[model samples]
Target: MMRSHRLFLIAMVAILATVLFRVPAKADYYGEPAELVDRATSVYKGFLADPNLEWFRNNVGSARGILIVPQMLRGGFIIGGSGGRGLLVAQDAATNKWSSPAFYSMGSVSVGFQIGADVSEIILLIMTDRGLDAMLSTDYKIGADVAIAAGPIGGSAKAQTADILAFGRSQGAYGGVSLEGAAISPLVDWNARYYGQPVQIFDILINQKWNNRQADSLRQLLPKPRRNAQPLGR
Candidate 1:
């Protein structure tokens, strides 16, 4: 009887600790680091190649810099399981090289008992000068002071040729959800591993160093920007 009581106490303590302090498990899809890196790089290059992406990148290039979060976050019903990390690489305007990429994680909670997963790539283009400035700080909250908008639809890429811009918004899985109320921060550890260089999140995303690489890559992959031949203006 005493042993049973002691075991119950231990189980309770474990449950409390899990709830109070929990870090999402590291994402290692297919257990291949090189494959993951290649996947991420390809996704970014694909965006650069898309004609619509070219106009979007150009319009936002005027911002102090851009913040890109390539995400894959999953969650479900009663079990409440979730975990996925992403890389955010900033481009430098003067140097034309990509800054080391930073890491970030995504989390969500729900009640029902639905079990499913989504795999997608995402990028947040900081369009305004003010948007980049605020994010450069140690900690920034979305929707509080920053102005954000839903990213353009891949299908409507042609329709949005005019370079309409907005603050940081999400792309990828469960599309159309706003990241306005989300908490985004820079990842110090990831930058060190991926680039073999020390970097802070703000330095990569806000400063203009890596910005140039992104701009140049897009330009090379896409046609020069031009006005929309078929105006939806009317």
Candidate 2:
């Protein structure tokens, strides 16, 4: 009897170890910085090509910064959560040039009558300096720290004045989508690996401390700011 009990415990331990090893880590979702940049470029190009997002193209010239989450997943049986990795780039007011990309992660959770899952590609346009400043912190809640509104679609949304505008292309069967309490934070491990050193979000987007040549394609896709445009402010 003693021998049988010991054998059972060992088998359980071994099975647990195998299960742990099979599961991928958070770092796996980040991929390489170059690969992420390429994906971001593709996402942006797809937005431009979509006729429903023509308002985005028209108003992009006035944006202070843009954050692109190539893919975000949300699902639940009863309780629910959503999360994804993304990159953000700021535009220089004087030169109208985009800075190096800074990586971030966004997540939200809810408990209600919800089921199934959905995947979405989200783009956030920082329309004011206040919105950009909020993102520079270590972390913040979307609607709590800063304001965000659903971007108007098609060509009819002409005069938007929100601090931040969000647009998403979602596919899958989900009850509904809500990002009101979503938290946005810097992806520290991913950023360190991408830059090959520990760096701050401001260093990448504000100070221009490092540059990756692979991001050239993404930089080119950013819309040029209107000439002599004043910086975004209240």
Best by TM-score: 2
Per-residue alpha-carbon lDDT of candidate 2 for residues 147-228, written as tens digits (9 for 90 to 100):
7787877666555566788888876221113467888999888788888889888888887887877788898888897775
Note the Cα lDDT for every prediction shown.
0.46, 0.76
- Candidate 2: the clashing residue pairs are none
Put down candidate 1 lDDT per residue, 100-164, tens digits, no spaces: 44555444444565545444455565444456555555555565566566556454444232111
Count of clashes, each model: 12, 0
Q: Residue 87, candidate 1: how far off, in angstroms?
A: 3.0
lDDT of 2 at 73: 72
Give the 10-residue window scoring lowest on summed lDDT in candidate 1: 160-169
User: Runs in model 1 with CA error above 4 Å?
Assistant: 1-23, 26-37, 49-64, 79-83, 91-100, 106-115, 154-175, 195-198, 202-234
Best lDDT among the predictions, by candidate number: 2
